[model samples]
Target chain A: MSLQLLFDALSLGGIYAIAALGIALIFGVMQLVNFAHGQFIACAVFALILPSSQAVAELGLGRLPTPLLIPVILGFGAALALLAEAAVFRPLRNAAPVALMVASFALGVALQNLLLVIYGSRPKAVSLWAGLGHPVQIGGAQVPLLQLLVIGAVALILAGLALMLKHSRIGLEMRAAAQDFGMARLLGVRANRVISGAFALSGALAAVVALVMVAQTGVADVRMGGQIMLIAFIATVLGGMGSLAGAVAAGFAIGAASALLQMALPAEARPFRDAFLYGLVILVLLFRPQGLFAPAGAKPRV
Target chain B: MLSQHTIRRRMAASTPLVLALGLLAFVLLATTMGDRATARMATETLIRVTLVAGFWIFVGNSGVVSFGHAAFACVGAYVSAWLTLKPAMKGTLLPGLPDLIAAADWPALPAVLTGGALAALLALVSGAAILRLSGIAASIATFAFLAMVNTIWANWTPVTGGTSSVVGLDRYVTPWVALGWAVAALIAASLYGLSASGLALRATREDEVAASASGIDRYRHRLLAYVLSAFFCGVGGALMGHFIGVINPDAYYLNLTFLMLAMLVVGGIGSLSGAVAGVLALSLAVEGLVRMEKGVTLGATTFALPAGSQEIIIAAAMILVLIFRPAGLLAGREITLPARWVTGRGTTHNGPATDRRET
Candidate 1:
């Protein structure tokens, strides 16, 4: 009922939407689950949490402005995405989807453990919040100014994404390939390159979300990746795996529902928040099968 | 391809011996581990081996992956847990039940059988609803089934104790008891692997459309394998509950499901010996590796390697097998009673003396 609670829920939704979009972007291209997706979120959070992100904050791009931190995280995410594609996905390009899915899931486990070896499993806090100062009273309610910034940033990213997918050359190639891989191949679309680019973008989105959330929460745990993986998966499933808009929408829906569920139930029922949210996605799947907002499957379901 | 003859000869020389060795190890380990650890390990492995075997039964035969098997395990674990716990709790939580189940106490026997039956019942009911969809939808639907069970167990706390681990069961399992079940599982798995229907299952696994054209009811056979798999999985769960003396909902997580899967793939999908080998080898590797991890903590810093080494090892092993031997370690190939010993019909170069593996 409180404005603070409502805004908090929105911010959480925004964070989830960003992470889900990252997963959806890659999935939208090649239908790979990118099981390592959670690891991407983890990598970004760890990258930001390391003393390096702090050192950056103390100097050049770090202290420049809070807004600039966004791209630093994004760039880091993009690089990781490319590296993952090169190392994990590319090698298995010709393999069956299940085989790839299984391998990537294995990669996800590997990525999580790699973080464990480096960070040693003790939670770390990324000081992205250092400059943000404090909360402000918006109307009669106290709200963190940092959360509003994240929501605004999410809007900007979504707009930029829309532009990229709708108007950019690489995006065009990616879309073409997704629409028809064989035909796209015949038409001179380099399937591997388009998918790799998509992965880079997906990885970037995961980083941006991680930076925002780490700022809000102030702790970067290795398990953050698993949470994102599950949320992104639910969003992907609910949105129809390859549809970005659907993923974004489902992401927001899941986020808001999870946040609200915290208030709606007692402490005992809180852990069931995700369980209920995923269960809703399942029900939607039972009937829609394709997705609630499945672009190609739109007519029949609606 | 290494000429068909070479492949055949290699398979002929290697298969039976490996299968025998693998099966021998599982039995010896189960028996030699003595009562306590054996009961614990054997029960958990039995349940898992059943899950993997069931998965292969459907996944191998139908070539479709079902991600929702944990749902059935949850169904069986909770159903049996509930039925057994219900009798005890009626005198407490469910004071409303009739005095028979309410006031009376039926022993563990009624509970476990009821648990397995209940799990199968849920599967039958759920199968009726979702079995018609094939491929991705089916996979997702099964995932939904797992989510549904997860949600039910979480919300219906009086029965499952929600996300908190379920406890207070009264059975201390012995390895001998679990060994009996393990042997039963092996027999069931071997018999299923060799049955007339086993051939049908294998046929379906090879090519569903072709098998269907040959007049096999693909759905019926898949459903049968799935239910049977659930039955074994349920038995395994009951044994596990008795063995560990505690049951947390988290125990049946997707990661755990994947653990069973990793074992199967690495063991060589579809083969019975492979399933046993996968479970025993991986279980030891995992448990062994976890206990070996080192940990440290400093001011505001608690560092743990966690029990994660085994998972990484299994994952690495799985990727290697998938890359090199995608057909699985054994594929559908059997380790029949070393051909010459069984039939005496064949030739030499592999000669009688050479065939006598011991000499």
Candidate 2:
């Protein structure tokens, strides 16, 4: 039971970590919380199927061989993010953070509505690698193959991101921009290049989340991304707004807390798990409003 | 000779009066010329005015964006539902409601006031903890608060009917009733904006360090505004329940939260006039698009936008507005006596003399 619970926690945590990374990437550089990110994830999930008002998704990209499917879906996500940047965000780059936030929200609404127009309001079923749902016995425990895969994927992605941020030139620029945008610009970091780079990486991470979530649930829902997106957003804040590593760690912590709370709470009280989780969030903010792993200069000097 | 102070004060009072009159005129026009549907729409718009004005009280003055006001609205709606529903219906639909509440069936006015009072009490309790934080952190905390309230409301099935719509609310809201509450809300907001704490709060918003140095208690003032704002929002929620004749937890969820915020932002979060104007303009545009979606007869043919295109178009419009006019259409100014008209020609008054101080 313990080992199964451990797998459950890690799988949920992995999904949230990737989603948080996507949000943190954009926030680090631009100081804009992209509220439309949930929509981006939803769009990626929808991309797997042909556009139709029918209840069942016709496997469009999902029918492709794995090798071609991965790259195409990731590209779709990246292109969507880039299109949004050019069409909406880029024009309002110089506006106040609040204005940018509101615009992103508007963009999210537009995307959701567009999806509704194309696919209708009902949730669609998309079967991909259903064979992976089989439980595998390991070390006196039963864990699903997909859960193991999700954990591995999360680890691989985190390591790759760490190396990229450490060694790549664009990664260095992204870090600088996230740390201090005005100073980075003054110091000659290319603004448009870094911003676009961050958006691309964020979009790719969103796609990764979409694929995992679809695999786990065996369903594609326009509304599916919102719940995870909200949890990931909280993780980003709890980990510190611009801190990628912090976001990942906080994501894991939140997932673990949720799993344990579900296990420990009485059946009658289990429905209130989110209420308890969010209450903890408020308490954490009261104690350390800058977040647990906040970077330097997060607090006001005055 | 009247001093500048007295003139500014009178203009400050004039702003709300002007806004109330404008709203009243719209209500009257809708009632006289339009059908019942238009009257209902007008009522919805007025209820929104009350909400947005309530929203502006805190956000405009404190520069803090709150996502939890809808939770207060939720509280108000449910409270009003508990009060106004037939006691027999309550017994069946809300078995978990305390015996006293289940047994009592009250009229609408007192029910609405009690709903607002409950929400104000909640704001006071929550704000005591939440207002201690500042900036984006406070905003996030409010979001969490909203999530918490929603979760509880969804699960507390016996009392709230859980995720299902709680029906049987009396449809007591007319265009005139909405106008009356909206005017009351506007007057409250306007009076608060010109109050000493309101000025101090705005000062803190502009420059927190400077305001603190000048002896303003930012947290205290913020809490006061929050409580006052929650009261009107709660009333607005009760009014919405009466208007729609149904109350649902989902109605006051993130969708409503964002809708209210979008209205506030598009109107210009900086001033009262911006709030009022934003609601009127956007509500009109939305009503028009909704009609077009139902199909419009233009000259020879009936044309309709794609079924879901109204939301997409509205969202795109909001984004465009932000891109072009980030401070919103009003840019933090108010409708006031024109300098040319008030001071007469050749004086060439520099600006709206009392506008900046009022905002």
Best by lDDT: 2
Position B139, candidate 2: lDDT: 74
**lDDT (tens digit, per residue) of candidate 2 on A209-281:** 9999888898888788777877888898899888998999999989998999999999999999999998887
Off by over 4 Å in 2: B298-301, B337-359
Cα lDDT of model 1 by residue, B1-359, tens digit = 24655554554445434544544465567677666555466556655665666556556555556666666666656555555664655455544444554444546777666766777777676665456554544554565566666666666665466687767666645645655555565566555555567668678667667777899876676676667666666666776676666776667656766786787777767676666667767777775566556555567876655556656777788787777777566564656444444344455344333222110
Q: A167, model 2: CA deviation in Å?
A: 1.0
Candidate 1: residue B67 lDDT (0-100): 62
lDDT of 2 by residue, B1-359 (tens): 55667666766668887788778889889999999889988999999999999989999999988889999999999999899899999988999999899988899999999999999999998888788876766776787789889999999999889999999899999998999999999999988999999999999999999999999999999999999999999999999999999888989987788778878877788889999988988888889998998999999999998777877887887887798877777888876554344333446656535343222
Q: Native-contact recovery for every candidate? A: 0.22, 0.74
lDDT (Cα) of model 1: 0.67
Best candidate (score: TM-score):
2
Interface RMSD of 1: 4.4
After TM-score superposition, what is the CA distance of residue A143 in candidate 2 from its true location, in Å? 0.9
